[model samples]
Target chain A: MRRSAFRRSRGDAPFRLASTGAGVVLLAIMAAIGVFLVVKAIPALQANTSNFLTEKIWNPNAVEPAFGIGALAFGTVLSSFLALVIATPVAIGVALFISHYAPRRLAAVLGYVVDLLAAVPSVVYGLWGVVFLVPFMRGPSEFLNTYFAWIPIFGGDQVVGKSMLTASIVLAIMILPIIAAISREVFLQAPKTQEEAALALGATRWEMIRMSVLPFGRPGVISAAMLGLGRAMGETIAVALILPATFGISFEILGPNGNSIAANIANGFGEATAVGRGALIASGLVLFLITLVVNMAARLVIARRKEFARAA
Target chain B: MTTVQTGIQPISTGRRVKDRIVQMLVYLAFAIAVVPLLSVLWLVVKNGIGRFDLEFLTHSMRNIGARDAGGGAYHAIIGTLEQVLLASLIAVPIGLLTAVYLVEYGPGGRLARWISFFVDVMTGVPSVVSGLFVLAFWVLALGMPFSGFAGAMALSILMMPVVVRSAEEMLRLVPNDLREAAYALGVPKWRTIVKVVLPTAFTGILTGVMLAVARVAGETAPLLLTVFFTDSINNDPFNGPQMGLPLYVFDQAGRPTDTAIDRAWTGALTLILIVMLLNLVARLIAWWRSPAKRGS
Candidate 1:
């Protein structure tokens, strides 16, 4: 009896320890990522001659190493911001379609199809952007240049298909499924009684949704959009392939002039000396910080939503 | 209290017109979103079908120049399979254990809450950042070579949070009654989890694992930093440069030649097939084992 009791008590110890260890290991890895990247980036920052944040040129491999994230950061933020602007409304609309507009039997299937868009590898998107979308974007780009030339973004004389606009479009498509999927879940969670009450009040379908679903799902949509923005900013392969690799900080998005931090890392890594790799890592660190802030804000919104739901 | 209208009432014409317009816009949004998917599929098939044949499947790019038309992604296929398998090996056990800890052992505990939140944070780490992490720590610090194993380390980081999230969801779905019943039989908590809880969640966990695999298998950026591309095959994941399907597509697409572009399309098509197949199979398993379908 004493032996059996002893066995029972000790039996779960190893299993519990193993699992706790796994969790600790995961935490360690996350900490290590930040620590090691900082360690690797310090030397590169010290080697730089010019302002690392403001200089336009990237000549990190030279003896007088001079590089800056000005152009890369500018392009990354610009393209991702443009992508967010273009994708948010469409993503919300698509979410509404899946949650409220589609026939009941078709909604699940349609949602799955949208998710397939996410499943397409980024490299494949890069290929499609280069071979197909780039050429096809020419007419639209030129049209924007002609009609919207008064706008600073479309004022550039050179209208190349491989421009910031095209990269933003690709990023928008890539992030649409992420936003739509989250928003659809939230839209579907809107109180059924509220929806019914709106419809019973002789409100039209769209008005009913606007009154019932939109308000409840606002936080979710915002969080989803932020997540999508984070994704767009970090997107590497597609932008790397689509952009013409120009190093300039300009708002003329229709011109073939753009380079993002992630794209620069991918494009430059092959030929980079040790210092160049460090510089790229430092830029990646900047991207990491940007996305981290965005994601944390998204999580905060979600946490607030949970509290709101509980109060309701 | 005044009674609301008892009869059917028509909404205002203006309201109806606005509703119709918004409805059309919603449908248009869905249609617009789908165009790229259909276009990508159609174009991939159209362009890739010609080169995705026996020679392409069997041969490697070996000595083939960018202008050459007959080269294949066989080498890349080998590297991707090996790296992904290595990644799965590293990620699955730890992810499973972490999920178990979160759902079974430490629900609502301080450590569990912190792990859960950090896992969410980890999910937001960019794939390229994961690559850079491994490049800094494994390759540079530890002085490891550019090998598929190093690439697998990066891919495994990307894979872990995905696995933990899915697995936690699956474990959470396990009814508490099952655990109680095992406990009533004087079974230890560990055995109950091992023999009872795990078996119940097996198919669901498998589905999650497969989905995680599919996600990491397509990762190119991490592989770019860790694997360092090669045109020839390297069967051993622990040594030397390797090629992955996505990297193959990226490399070939970068080349300014028709044949290289064709090869890139074929590589992409192959990758899509592999990823989609995994997804479909995972969904099928989940559907087959779903409690509602089983009427349990």
Candidate 2:
């Protein structure tokens, strides 16, 4: 290694400089995003009459210039959590089917279909959600509100179709392809020998999958879910189009009250005052932080899996 | 051996039933997963194909009334093409270089690890947040007018990480034997990469970059905030507000008129077709240029 280093080519310097500059540019962009958000948000935070974290009212345009992100954060977390709940099992099932059960041709076709679904843009999804899903969900929302009224999330009297439940369902559809694609790749990577051993032990196909495939795919599925959660939390258009924006916080998802940070920023940015824009940026800062944590968690899981693979 | 043959007994009916049920569930899962995708495509095509004519592709919405049934998305298509081209121009090179560094120069270094981590984080940053970043820095701080270039800055942010991630994967797939062969011939390291490694991975890198472009080209949030909408065609991207396909769809949909609603559907169809076409081309390149395809 030392000898090779001593004999380094003269052309190395410029190439190395260019590549390192590119890498540093990525780091600098991330830092710059953080710094600029903070710098711009300072005045918005100071000019506020109420707590930026606790107040529920958004009146950045008023004489007092008061606002808070409590409701938006709640709605964002609640809706994304629900989306993760809805998407994870379905994604796992689809992944398992593709990796293990489907015929070869069918698996290939289904894989392509999922890739197409991912390629379908978010605005298009928002269009479909508003035109079809909003009306389609009205019946179900009413049913849940009527029959499942014992639950707090379904206890609301009003059954607005454009509610948190509706937004979450849209988010679920948006994230499903990503989680399914990642988990399918992971499941397909499970050791063939282990699967054969399980089958040789007279295990049924389901039992064999349970023993050989799912255990290996667990970490991958967790990371996929985290990634999906990140996507759902940051999703803007679909939620903006579907959810009826209300500043009031409500535990009842079946009611007409839900607003994510991204959705709020998109919906309200047009009519905002200068301070309102800053407050929106501050909300975006929160969104950036949330997604950053979720993505880092996913990366940590993937890193651990790599280490485990190396050890094995 | 004859005695061992009797050890094999017929499987229980319960096990058979379980297997059948599991297999059925698998099929059901596939159907559930596919139904929404097909429905979306179906609805878009069914409603949008009416106005997808040459006139729709060539005329701008400059003076047309919202209720008047005759304007098209020509300006939007032009704006989208220019902005996406600018974004690709800015992002692809930086992304490819960063990927080269990660794969070739900074394999296990601390900076490499940090870069990889931040890129992951960047991957999940909301599109609106990227728009906000640019709005604060470029539009407000630097005093640049809202233009397609400003929108390109945000789009580049979103595109770069995607390009880096995919390009890194493609670069890593270039076998070490090729690099070793180049070095054995006394070629410089940089030449080995540019001539041998890059060429070998060129098709895969192209597909990755194309996919990245497709992903960002459909983005509406960044353009909505940065490029602020315009109705007329603007040849200059660096000067004023520009209309993009996604933003055009959004603006049309928000109008309370039937004609505008129809235009929204058509605009969406155009955008989806552009994106899907990019994806299909990428897939075709991957299929045709795969090393295994040559052997087969």
Candidate 3:
């Protein structure tokens, strides 16, 4: 609003100071989290017998206390990447359908459905994944293994459902709504004049979208995918409930082997000792860093897009 | 070559076929997306409806065993409400003031940019990591006992960003003309915000706050470490461990027996219903408050 008279008043200083204090509280909280995690994680790192990054074993509670994040980090990256690969195209397609292809009423209903899917708690997804999806996925896992055995990741003899593939699928479902919602917003915001120009030419519907909408939404799609990737990497309850926890890092996605940092912490923390709790906190720091990098990268992408759009 | 020589050319068979195929693919994609959601809701309702009754809502699982039949989520319901209310009490004021600062005083300022960036980063922080932070700080370093208060603190960390972002959007939507009018009448900026700007954005702020509450109420990872999941009722959140619906569902689902699994499904159903109710109310309030704001 136009606050010319208010701006001329002398009382603006105190209000500004009060709001700045509130803003500083947020900064303080973020700083405290980083400092606390580092301070608490140091002693456990000092006590470790194995290399914290490269070793594959986790034994923080043992007398010797050998521990590493090799397997957990591997599984976290692998499943999250797989989830992004599976969810990105489908989410983009659904976003396109809702924004362009569907009729108005249907689009509204579908959008609400997607929002409801997002509202479902992670624990509920965990319950559904464990109760229904795990057993249901066995047949598909077996089929994939039987048909695609030439592929290394699908060649494992044990085609048990509770494997990396299963966890990735669950993560895909968990993240689909977020990607769809974000991209839908982006797609809906495409310039109408550009779409009309493409259509006023002799272009088909799909051609119009490709020429006008897709190019406009490219940066948005990237940031949305990154957001989904961040969530998949840090998701705790669903992956914990589904993936049969294992410490081995193998390429066989169909094999019964997987572990993520957040899942490991959630599964192991209840009965942990002092060092074990510290070790989990140390791993949590790693998780925080990964998420932070991903989120910052996404924001960088968005900020660059805004500069380009403004310049253009 | 013969078809597109003129300005108003006829549509070709090849182009028509491509359009049909792409349209079919889009429809197929939509169907594929909806399948998992439908199946999850169907299964929860199918399995949980049998146990979702008055007895289940009223009684507690105090004396129930793996084989026993009768139990309820009365204690968990109370615990979830108390913890969520406490967390909202802590988060809403800070979040609102920060948002007010961003919109009213520091739009595009250096500190505002930094604050907004960290808030976005905070939004992506995992629920379990927040739990770990609280465990490391409150329970471990400070030697505080595990209780619902600790869980509320962790949940506040998660809820504050949601409230800030949503409330910021709402505050930005308030018209500049209104503020200008107040200023023209010789009113101070703070009074204008308190008397005029806030009232205009109150319903929007309420919706945002309620949505944040819904989200944190369903968070189990934080409570797993903080509240620690008791079976019996604990009235005081400051003194003792408390039962929450999400934690109860997780604990029940971990059991090996069929009855326990059944209860887990029922608990999941209850949690979903609670979240759905809050979401519906939030949406309803938004819709009721702004009937003219459509589509966007």
Q: Model 2: DockQ against the native?
A: 0.70
DockQ values of all predictions: 0.74, 0.70, 0.68
Better of 1 and 2 by TM-score: 1
| Alpha-carbon lDDT of model 3 | 0.88
- For residue A83, model 3's alpha carbon misses the true position, in angstroms, by 1.0
Measured with C-alpha atoms, the lDDT of residue A223 in candidate 1 is 88
lDDT tens readout by residue for model 2, B157-182: 99999899878888998999999898
User: Which residue pairs clash in candidate 1?
Assistant: none
TM-score of model 3, chain A? 0.93
lDDT of candidate 1 over B1-296, digit per residue (tens)? 25457665556689889999999999999999999999999999899998999888888899997577798989999999999999999999999999999999888799998898788778888999999999999998999899999999999999999899888888888999999898777788889889999999999999999999999988899999999999887888889999999999999999999999999999999999999999999999999999899995
Task: Record all residue pairs in model 3 with backbone atoms less than 3 Å apart, i.e. clashing.
Answer: A1-B176
Off by over 4 Å in 2: A1-8, A307-312, B1-6
lDDT by residue for model 3 over A13-55, one digit each (tens)? 7877887888889888888888888888999999999999988
If both were scored by TM-score, which would come out higher, candidate 1 or candidate 3? 1
Candidate 3 residue-wise lDDT at A21: 84
What alpha-carbon RMSD in Å does predicted model 1 have with respect to the real structure? 2.9
